[model samples]
Target: MALVLPFEPNEPSIEALVALVKADMERVNATILARTGSDVAMIPEVANHLISSGGKRLRPMLTLACASLSGYRGDGHVKLAASVEFMHTATLLHDDVVDESDMRRGKLAARKLWGNEASVLVGDFLLGQAFKMMVEVGSMTCLDILATAACVIAEGEVMQLAAAKNTATSEDDYLAVIRGKTAELFAAACEVGAVLGQRPKAEQAACRSYGMNLGIAFQLVDDALDYGGSQAKLGKNVGDDFREGKITLPVLLAFRRGDASERAFWQRCLEKGEGNDADLDQAIGLMTRHRAIADTVERARHYGAIAKDALALFPNGQAKDALMEAVDFCLSRAH
Candidate 1:
């Protein structure tokens, strides 16, 4: 039997916000397809395949939610939200190629289906398209934030590559990598919304901080799920990070807690980048003994609380409530 996880419905206000974002996304997608042209039809196809795949679209939704919470009532939010989605999609395309991942959202990855060369080129094209959209939005400040985020994301990827299979990675180092690779763009999304809304600089910074912390919590929970969640619920195979030799929070904690014999087992599997079922069971057992999964969950909850605290500066409203709900949702999601 396949595993199933529970999901709560979004808050009522979130439903309305989601509708607006979806309508805007369709328009933006149309614009992208038209710009790509008929001669490059495959580009649109591949792009659409990835775009239409079922994702929470959390980043773009964050842009919209933040803008609305700040009393923004303008059409420009749509374009800005679309820009976030484009940037996110571009990153996913490139990440799949880099990770050699075959599945995403329970579907074949764009790189796996269309080949890595096509995927990378399309990813670059999306990045260029995102910048073009930013220019059209006509906010120099927004552009600067996004451009800087792009650089930080690249740096984070490099940092992760260096940290891979290195069990000595500290919690602080892991936080830095997660902030760059995952949270920076999320921060940029909300920050751009504040810029568009002409919000106060301090409030804008708060929104960015909220997004950043929420993103870190989201990714941390994701890493924990890899160890604790079933494949049917997670939409991917079990022990994927183990197979890829990626050292995440649980593994780091487990290593720190391990004794001599347990440490030797990790050295063979993690250091040498090779593990079988028995090795995976041993690793899981060691992690359980160390209570690493619970520790990671505590870390995720801490960030989620920080995210909620960041919104305290904003006035109470349905949008603000929905934003708070999103933080709760991130911490509570089963997969």
Candidate 2:
């Protein structure tokens, strides 16, 4: 018989998958706290501020779930999961700095409280610690996967910088940006679990594919949500991306499909960076007319289906089911 863990409902919740990995996650959490500590008062203070804040820890949980699903029975998965979280946190600190974002997780951004210099340095400190943890895990293959992902994520940021405020940014350009900044880590997080679990090369590739597609879906939904999602859940204002002049997929589609006068409106607000509250309202209206939100969600569902299919080799069990449900959860957030 295949391995089967417990869940209360027929349909699994992401919370249920989280529960299934509670034991491993406990170790990962401990590892995170221990690694983030520092003798310098400010390093620990700034790092812990974001680490302790109520982030969902989903990426790390993916690490743990993939390990368990592939029959991992050792402690290496714990350290690897912690490394994934550190990578994510480091990126968040740096991203907020780059985006000049005002809020995070419904609170004052660490940069706001501690200043930009502190935030960037703290982010660097987290990356250093994350690398140290990866080295200690003693899996060069895992280390190589994560290190490459880090580089790709940086490249993605640079790509976004190049594309920013360019109304002509193509859908392929946007895909490349998100694939690096968002999906690469998700891919690394799941791929490393297979490595630690001693899964075959094909299984490892499958895990990576699953994570990559799911991450794409997740990001697409986020793009939609930024224009239409509830701020209470998002911890930021609706149209934050628009205010920043980001050329997300929704805007890309609407820009391409709109009339000449509509293109001029986009040029005035996004291309010229003259956005105001009323301008954002108009942008949302334009997206609505062009069916950008619905289309984006439709694209997300397409990727979500690919993510589901990627897990076909895995047996019906708690981890597999949870991971499958996770694909649904990523898409559902837009609703």
Top of the candidates by lDDT? 2
lDDT of 2: 0.91
* Runs in model 1 lying further than 4 Å from the true structure: 1-38
Off by over 4 Å in 2: 1-12
What do the candidate models score in CA lDDT, each in turn? 0.83, 0.91
TM-score for each predicted model, relative to the true structure: 0.91, 0.95
* Residue 255, model 1: Cα distance from true site in angstroms: 0.7
Tens digit of lDDT per residue, candidate 2, span 51-73?
88888898999999999989999
Residue-wise lDDT of candidate 1 within 199-304, one digit each (tens)? 9999999999999998999899988888888877677776888877788999989988888777777777987987887878878888888999888989999998
Question: What's the CA error at residue 250 for candidate 1, in Å?
Answer: 0.7
